[model samples]
Target chain A: MHIAFDPRLRVAGPLQALDARCKVLAFFALVACAASVPAPSWRAPVAFLGAATLLLLVSRIPLGAALRRLLFLVPVVLALAAVVPFAKAAGGEKVALWTGGPMVPRQGLLVLWNVSSKALVGLLCAIILAGTTGVPRLLEAFERLCVPRVLVLTMSFIHRYAITMQEELARMKRARDARGWRGRWIWQAGTLGSMAGTLFLRSYERGERVWQAMLARGYRGKLIGPSSAPLRLLDVMFVVWMLAAGLAIRFLVR
Target chain B: MTAPAIRVSALTFRYPDGTRALDDVSLEVAPGERVALLGANGAGKSTLLLSLNGLCDPGGRVEIGGTPVGSRNLPEIRRRVGLVFQNPDDQLFCPTLFDDVAFGPRNLGLGEEEVQKRVHEALHRVDLATLEEKPSFHLSYGQKKRAALATVLSMQPEVLALDEPTSALHPRARREMIALLRTLSCALVVATHDLEMARELCPRAVVMARGRIVATGETSVVLADTKAMDEAELL
Candidate 1:
C-alpha cells in the first residue's frame, strides 16, 4: 500500500540525466527481449542480466536497494515454481535426490530455471528504470509516447495524493489509539471496517475538492500540455543501442 | 469607474442532499481590491468561492472581468479567477512542484519557455524555487501551502479566491503567507478566520451567515460591528 516517498532518490544522476522516454523505451525493449530469449541456453539470459547490472552501475543506484526490492518477489516466484521440480513433465528425465525419495523431473527443473531467469531479468530492468526516473518524468514520458491522457493523469494524481492519504490514515489511527478502549476480535473488525468507510468518504470529499481545483485552473476535460523538451541526442543513442542489443539477443544469439 | 474584477449577484446554491450552501449571495470586488470572506464553519464561505469560479452547478450570476461565468466562458473565467482551496493537496494535483506551479500557465496554452519562466517566477515569489523539481508530497505543510499559492499565482489571474490560506501553518509561516498575499496586485477574496490577516492584507470584508452575505464594508468597520459579528456568530 505504500512505496517510498523519498525525493532524494530522484535528484540528478547519470541515468536520471537521460530523457525519460529514452529510459522507458530502452528498459522496455530490454525486458521484452529478455523475456523472449530462447530457452536451453544461458548465453542470452546471462547477457540480459549483465546489461541490467550495467544499468544499475551507470545509474549509480544502490545495488542493495535494488536487491532488497527483488527480495520481496523471491517468495512469490518460489511459490509459483516450487512444484516444478517435483512434478513430472511429458518426455522428461528423472534424477534421484536420495535412495528412496521420489525422483525429480529434469524437464521441470529446466522449465523452472527458464522461468526464474527470465523473470529476474525483467524485474531487474524494471527496478533500474523505476529507480532512475521520477514519477513526474515517467508521466511526461507516457504522455509524449501518446499513451492515453486519462491514464497518465490518473497516475499523476494518485502519486501526488498518496502521501496525503497515508497521513490521513495515520491521523485516524492515532485518534483511535488515544481512546484507550480495549480491543477484542469483535471491536477490531467493526473498528477497522468503520475506519475504512470513513477513509472512503474522506477520500471522496477530497476528490470533489480536487476536481473543483482542477476546474478552477482551466482544466477542460483534458490535461494541459506536458511541455517536455524534445528527446536529446543522448536519448536517441541510448534507445538505439538498447534496441539493437535487444534485437541481437532475440535473433542473432541463437 | 471600470467594472468590478469579480461580480456576484443573487448567487444561490444548494447541495443535492437538500442543504442550502449559499442563499442569494451578492458581492463585488473592484480591480486590485482585497476582500475578506469571514464566516464560521458551514457558513458557506467555500461554497461561495466555488460559485465564483463557476464550479457550482448552474444557478448563479458570476462575472469575471465583465465576462459572465457560464459553460462556454468557464475556462476564461477560471483562468482569470484563481481559487486556492483550503487544502493544499486539493489545489496541487501535480506530482512535482514545478508541474503544480506551471499547471495554470500550461492550461492557458503558454509556450514551454513561457511556462518555465512563469513557474520560476511563481516559485521564487513563494521562495520555493530550490524545491521546484521536488515532488509536492515531499514538501512540508507550509511549503505545500506556499506551493499551492504558487499554483494559483502562475495563472496571473486578475482575481484570486483563497480558502483558509493560513489555516494549517505555523505563526511564522502564517506571517510569511500574509506578506506573500500582500505583494500580489490582483483583486483577492480570501475566505478565512485570520482577522489579523484580513486586517493586514484585505482592506474590505464581507461576512456570511446562513448562506447569505450578512455584512460588507471596510475591514476595520466590519470587524468593529459587534452586533453583526454577534449575529453571524463569528465571535
Candidate 2:
C-alpha cells in the first residue's frame, strides 16, 4: 500500500505538496470538464489540454515524459473510436489505402483526433494525480470526500494486498519455472485454473484471519477512523483556485 | 477474594468446522503478572487466547477482569482484554499508523481528544512516534509488530494477550520486543516457542498440549523440567 507501483508515471513535483483532497477534487473536476463536450469542439478540449499542460509546467514536472506516455495509449483510443469516422461517415468522400479493408474516410481522421485528444487529456490528469499522491493518502482523501466506507475500505485492502498477490503469483511462476513448465495458456489450462483456485482460497483464508484480528480490536462493524482535522488554508486555497480556473477556462473556451 | 486479571475455568472450544481446538482448559493470571503460554504447533494455544475475550465462543467460563465473556459483556471484555494476533499484517489493516493505533480507543467511544492522546502515548511507548503518518504496509516487519502492539496498548487493556509476538523477528528485534514487554504494566500472556524469551520477560509459565494444560508453574521451573518439556513437545 505504501509502495504505489501503479504502472503510471507520476512526476513528484510541486503538485505533490498540496493536500491529497485538493488534488482529488481538482483533477476529478478536470475529468468532468474534459468529458462534457457535446461534440468535437476544439475550444473546450484544447483549453483543457492547455490548462493541464500549464499545471504540469507550473508544478515543475517534466512535460515531455508525460506526453511520451500519451504515445502508448494513442493506438488504444484509435482502435476504439477510429471506426466511428469510417463506419458512420455520410460518405461524401473516401481515400484509398495501400493495404486496407475499408476505404479511409476524411471525416474519420478528424474524429480520431477528436476522440484521442479527449482520452489523452483524461488519462494524463489521472496519471498526474496517482503519480503524486500515495495510495494511503488517496484513500484518506476518499474518506474525507464522504465516499462510502465499504468502497473506501475495499480500495484500501486492494492497495494493501495487491503486492502480496503479486508476490504470490511470482512465487507460483518461479515454482513452475523450476519444474521446466513453460506454460501455454491453452496447453496448461488445468494447472493454471488450479493455481487460480489455490490463490483464491489463500486470499479468502487471509481475509478470515484479518477479520478475526479486527474483531479482537473491538471492531463493531462501524469503522472508527481518526477524526479528520479541518481543511487547512492551503487545501482550501488550492481547491478554490483550481475550480475557478477550470470553470473559467471552460466557459471562456465555450 | 480479588478477581484475577484473566480467568478461564473448564473452558472448551471447538471450531465451527468441527475441530476440537481446546478441551477443559483452566488457567488464571494474577494482576500485573507476566505469563508465558508455551506449546507446540496444533496445541490450541491460539484458540485458547481467542476464547479469552469471546472471539471464539467458549463452552465453559472465560472472564476478563471479573466480567464474563458473552455478547452482553463482550464490548467491556474486549476493551479490558487486548489480543494481538500472530501476524502484524492481520492486525494492521488501517491506512496509517495513527489510525491503526487509535482504532481501539475510538472503538471504546472515547472523545477525539482522548483518542489522539492515547494514540500518541501508545506510539511513544512503542518508540514509533515518528511513523504516525506512515502507511501500515510501508512499515518494516519489526516496526509493524511494534505498531500492532501499540494498537492494542492504546485501549489500556488490563490484560494483554500476545500470540507468538517474536515468531518472525530477528534476534535483535526479538530482544527489543522483550525489552518493550518488560516495561508494560498489564497482565501479559505471551504464547511463544522462545523459552529463553519466556524466561527473560515472564515470571510464570503455562504449557499446553493437545488442547489441555499439561503444566503450570514459575517460568524457570516449567522451562527447566526436561521430562515435562518433552511430554508437551515444546522442544
State interface RMSD in Å for all models: 2.0, 3.2
Candidate 2 regions exceeding 4 Å error are A1-23, A56-78, A92-103, A130-146, A170-194, A222-226, A232-237, B72-75, B94-99, B102-121, B127-140, B224-228
Every model: Cα RMSD to truth: 2.9, 4.2
Error of 1 at B32 (Å): 0.8
Residue-level lDDT for A6 in candidate 2: 39
Q: What Cα-based lDDT does every candidate model obtain?
A: 0.82, 0.81
Query: DockQ, in order, for the candidates?
Result: 0.69, 0.55
| Ten contiguous residues minimizing lDDT sum, candidate 2 chain A | A1-10
Instruction: Write model 1 residue lDDT over A1-254, tens digit each, in one string.
Output: 22234455554577878888888988888888888876566677777778878877887766677787788769867886777776655566787768887777876766677678788888787777777876667777888889898899797677656755776788888999899645766857799889889987887777777777888898775566556677789889999999999888777765
lDDT at A13, model 1: 74
What value does the lDDT take at residue A245 in candidate 2? 73
lDDT of 1 by residue, B1-235 (tens): 7988988888888889988899988888999999999988888999988888888864678888888888887878888998998889787766578888888898888998999999999999999999998878778999999999999899899999999999979999999999989999999999998888999998899998889888999999999998878878878
User: Candidate 1 chain A: minimum summed lDDT over ten consecutive residues — where?
Assistant: A1-10
Residues A1-254 of candidate 2 have per-residue lDDT tens digits of 12244323344567877788888998888767677664546677778888777776666544665666667786797586646666656765776555665577765655666677678778777657766775756777888789999998898667646655655677787887899887766778788888998877877777777778877888776665545566678877877777787777667776
Q: How many residue pairs clash in each candidate?
A: 0, 0
